[model samples]
Target chain A: MRSRSCIDERAARKAQPALRKVGRGASGRGHGNAVPLPGPASGRRDQRRGMPPMMRWETRDEICELVLADEPCNEIGTHMLEALERFVAEARKLPARALVIRSEVRSGFSAGADLRELYAGILTRPREEHVPALRSFLDRIHAVMDALDTLPMTTIGAVHGVCFGGGFELALTCDLLVADRTARFGFPELRLGLIPGFGGIPRLRREVGNAVVRDLLLTGRTINAKKAATLGFVSQVVAPGEATDVARRMAAQAARFDRDAAVTAKAFLKPLPREELAREKEHFVRLFQNPCVTEALRRFVESKDVRPYLP
Target chain B: MSDTVTRLMALAARRFKADAAKLRAEADFFETLGIDSVQALELLSELELEFDVEIPDYELQGVKTFTALAERIDKRR
Candidate 1:
């Protein structure tokens, strides 16, 4: 096993593992003359303090935990989405046997996209502008999700309470899901009149079957971890706060096998079809462009009310 | 305050689209900007690119105010 010693917070704070390309030292060519001002969270020059990173990578014993700091609850904003993709790429570039995705957020794995941003940006824009903006946004997001899906390494989603909408959609991309018993899993997107744009529907269909997906997607109700386990939504349903540790253990075991053989086996189990995935994106875009859907999203934002879909 | 600190604060105010004079050095980022985790990360990313310094997410996890942000950036520099 590849073992790693604990990274001292004081010392670790000084290193920028993700940005080594920029070059590190007492003085760099850019961002001239930064004075040492250690705050609650250590930061490189050119940043404000007292805020948490949306996501971080911690590598040890050949396993990397991409943690979503609690302060943020791992919400995926446009920038957060891009950062996640970048971080994944960097981790893949590094030598790691397995990847475990989890969150340290007290509330849950992630709260999904920023509703404030979504409502503010989408509502203010004119109706004609909605389709183009949404199309580009969906296209970019689909790329990020595709990045996670395409990783050669095994990935696990360690889920806890309140994984809804985009967060739930994200967890579906993982090869294995180890959910906490108290976890709540659901797609609340119907409330916003938008269907899953990041391949959630297809993944759910494959994992839980069409009937189950229909029930969950149509009703917009979340299931507890136990129910999800029985329904095959999760492989392991452990006690509260044990999701991340269990996932790590599982990743270690997976990493123990011959890397090539494991990868080949994974490829065999789910050979993702590019054509189908592309179709999924198109479907989301078309539906979002529909007048009814746009009107619903706008109404939801303006009134903060949920009007049940009649169709 | 150092020039670096003043500039960093100003940059943050602009990114958050808030009034520079109104932003307190000690205010929590989420509270002051009314932005979520992802937006905050975007601000960090913007700063990194703008100043050409690397601010790892782990290092900025506890930062919530202008003062802490300046301190964190200073340490990295």
Candidate 2:
């Protein structure tokens, strides 16, 4: 079987020079999207290592940064998920004072799951044939989030571009959310006839209250960074290119504390609340088995038109 | 390490999924226990909460063994 890591590495190496170019994607001009490494961009060698080098992990002083600096849409996929798992494991051991997660993908933080993978495979296949795979995938993703949510150190999500579906849920896991003006957050799973499968609903409800959560999930609507801030979740909303820079500074400041105190404080603020993560998977798979879901997702994959889920 | 420490470490090793028998006073994490950094930190945090003593990260930086950890906690207590 081909390892997901190898598949991701291949994709990373295939990027054009423009994709790996450092400092500010085309959208941010020179001030945007800092690549983790400084060099001539040896993505080729990185690919040889059989892992996506785009999603980078870095530690400076006592601070660690996990960057979602991917090309095109930086869509979340199994490979990216695997990379995050490895990064979190390492970060836990490092006992870093803070972890900053940010996306520099110009198109969006992520376009949710890799629509191609979802559509071409599960959506197009017989529901019974693919349900097991989808269930396994969601379970692994939840495990990743579980590890992330329980990390003993502080976490900041520096969000930019489109944070949709699972990607949006991933950002919400952070202790603090710092979004760029260009950032837009939403859950588009309804369009594909599925719910946010990664414990997003419970977390969203906790952050934004019941009514707003209903509006977002039911309508599959998106809110810009300013509106998100108004909702009382975003810690800071900055100009187009400043989210990462601001978030890093926030992390640096957060890192000044004694580690144990920070962990205790976080635990006090957000106790391990009862959640229905397992149920989310059960519901998601049940929904995915519906003919409506399969047809909707198939149509999405084929045409990319997104009108079905809208209210 | 004191016998009390040996007992404490036995519990800590269980939490870390490590063998308590290999957890020697002088084994020091990297040299003897071979506990990964993450496991070591896990043990530290578990111990801190267990003892209700805050172990500073600086103190943990050079700590290498079960004995060292016990000594640090003793000083704090």
Top of the candidates by DockQ: 1
lDDT per residue, candidate 1, A119-163, as tens digits? 444445666765676667667677777777667778899998657
* All candidates: interface RMSD: 19.3, 21.5
- At residue B54, give the lDDT of candidate 2: 53
Off by over 4 Å in 2: A1-52, A123-127, A304-311, B1-77
* DockQ score for candidate 1: 0.01
> In model 2, what lDDT does residue A237 have?
82
Query: A172 in model 2: Cα distance from truth in Å?
Result: 0.7
Clash pairs, model 2 backbone: A24-A32, B28-B64, B29-B64
lDDT of 2 by residue, A1-311 (tens): 11111112433544332222222222211111111111123234434244346577666767777778665556555556667776666667774788888876655566566554454455244545576677667777777887787788889998876677777878878899998766767776776667887778777776888898887778666666766888988999887678889989999899999888999998787554345666766787777667786586445544422112211
Tell the DockQ for candidate 2: 0.01
- How far out, in Å, is residue A171 in model 2? 0.3
